[model samples]
Target: MDISAPSLRAVFTAVKTEFNAGRSTYTPTYTRIATVVPSTTSSEDYAWLGEFSRLREWIGDRHINKMALHSYSIKNKKFEATEGIPSEYIEDDTFGVLMAKFQDMGYAAATHPDELTYACLASGWNTLCYDGQNFFDTEHDVGEGENEKLVSNMQDGALAPWYLLDTRRPLKPLIFQKRKDYQLSAKTDAGNSDHVFMADEYLYGVDARVNAGFGFWQQAFGSKAELTEANFNSAIEKMMGLKSDKGRPLGINPDLLVVGPTNRSKAKALIEAMQKEGGASNTNYQAVEVMVVPWLD
Candidate 1:
């Protein structure tokens, strides 16, 4: 495998094939729990998220809800992954390894969104949402004055966190803000590139601009306690009982449960089992789809 332009091009094609193949094999889980929001500039304002409205019977004039302009925004962040292969690797006929490397790179690139979304989710306990409250806090305002009731979306404890989500709605608990889709690029112009001339290497990389942020905290419940059936039931109860700012039922249906490697067995036994451990009829059987994600780990 001599370092001719044609040969280098052949290597690029092979590497790109592996990269695409890698991307094709991955099944990202973020789509299930995050809404994709396209961004045009460096950031997108979500200050309008201050309210969630519902349809009501018409009386007279239309009720207009003004955007609060709370300065809440999701800024796009640039991300990149790059690798350079020594010209000697192609000369040594080790392009197969490079193919695998690019494939893994593609896999990693595909998984990045999930990583950001879930990390944003996992930080719900502390990070603020559009309402100026932690996405999973216990002090979210449901109403004003005497009608106000402090609500919580999280249960704190000393263990790995698991999440219950209501994804039946169009908007999910998280937002994946993508400014630019991930793309693969190469700098194999050996005649013109200083990197190629000086380093005797060909560079390949993937880059994109994307970020993740919390959506409706009302549609999600996080627990750091043990992942038990009782706790699961409690989480479901909490989420289902959630009310809107106007004190209307949010109608949140917890349809998905997310867990990490440490809580896989617990999550499975709680939902996947046909019966409770006591031989009693399991009331929570197949209640919700359980997702096991390594990114959560």
Candidate 2:
């Protein structure tokens, strides 16, 4: 029941240390090349395949370090070069070539659906057009012939770009509460194709550990209830929650709560109340376990 200021601080210190130490490594690779090619189309339809080969080599050279860092297994030998160029050679066709190169190199490339969505989310790109023709109007216009195909591909229901980025930056600390709207803010930029963007519309009410702990206490002790009697029941319920019980109505109270200098006195008062009730009562209820972990600063 009683949550000592020092105890709460210690818990916070542990959490902070864990956060700093926790690291995530995400290695994304594009899908297989054969998967992207339309079976019905003749090989002649893609004459620009050579460009794709060159692109693959370029990407492998540039991203080798990143791939190594993430432990990707792709090697140049895996790339299966075609005998001759296909004939169609449309600008949109290049995407397929890019996909193949990515696969051969073992870089996780987005699925067709994800690819278009990602492009639109990045700066200098748009999935919609006034003419209802092209979905990806890059800062530089893609030729008219391929524009319609790109637009059509996008309308077919591509995944959002942020999804791909999430796969890449799985461990990035996110600011969840401020991102509750579908309309993305201009201030938030995806620094690289691999950087993940926390969706503005999905971040509402989400909090890191500190705020979450505060919320737990507010619900348990801030209610209009008797101090000596109610505090004892609340503390018991709070502990049960931490033990994995639902602790419904009150929800799971945090195992620990941290108090800064500003609120240290208030926290001490609450701890005293719990200590008294726990000592007097015959129940298992006791002082809330609080650990005081100080910030380095």
Candidate 3:
């Protein structure tokens, strides 16, 4: 059945709203987070993240918003925080105290895992880093050369210094193509005093780098265009045509198509359209695996 434009849009919007409402149940909290592995043996050191813009944002916009060309060299240091279980509380309580202790530990276990995914996804949707000069109505030159670091003092280093456009090193939040081989552990203090004890926890983190640029592994900007077969095909072309840092054509066949909840039906239609076996065959057939991401919406 043919769908009218207005009706189709409405359907897309409604699907997104409903999917978002029940999305929590289907979200795998660790899918993206668990991809990062230990970049360093010690947590005190910093993990370097790299990013390279395949194309400047202005090129795609109708209005040219001329901005500095950025190549990133951001650093992600492992963060350390402590949460403890009192011996008295766990030891004295007879009912569910042990379980409660375990629950608290679970939260601690989840904290870093959740944070890694959050940070990576957020960076993709947001800017890499901001230097104070680029605050309001102006933008800063990310500068050239790896030696030239755009260091922004975010509250006297309350967080790792946000760096911008360092050619020496490409930076991105930690993203890995292979399974991260590592373990999470909590260590008890060597000795206890005053019946108060402490356990220090450490999470291994990797800096974000471009594992897959302008392709399935990397997030793509959809230009606020409504999802459709034609539009989706165009996006795939744009993605495949993306250039590398070396200014060479990145002949990438994107194996996955990630969409927001609003694009679910559109994605399905695009896939089905490609599967037809005749003159009706869509040029882009099974171009990529489609994944509906509610978090992206």
Every candidate's lDDT: 0.89, 0.23, 0.36
Per-residue CA lDDT of model 1 for 26-90, tens digit only, reads: 88989899999999999998877756668888899998866556667998999999999998999
Candidate 3 or 2, higher TM-score: 3
As for lDDT, the candidate ahead, 2 or 3, is 3
CA error at residue 86 for candidate 1, angstroms: 1.8
- Estimate, for each residue in 219-238, the C-alpha lDDT of model 2 and write its tens digit: 11111122233443544453
Q: How accurate is candidate 1 locally (lDDT)?
A: 0.89
Candidate 1, superposed: residue stretches over 4 Å from native: 1-4, 91-94
Better of 1 and 3 by lDDT: 1
In Å, residue 88's CA in model 1 sits off its true spot by 2.8
**Top model number, TM-score:** 1
**Candidate number that wins on TM-score, 1 or 3:** 1
Per-candidate TM-scores read: 0.94, 0.17, 0.44
Sorted by lDDT, highest first, which candidate order results?
A: 1, 3, 2
Give me the candidate number with maximum lDDT: 1
Flag regions of model 3 displaced more than 4 Å.
Answer: 1-38, 41-71, 78-89, 92-115, 129-222, 243-248, 272-285
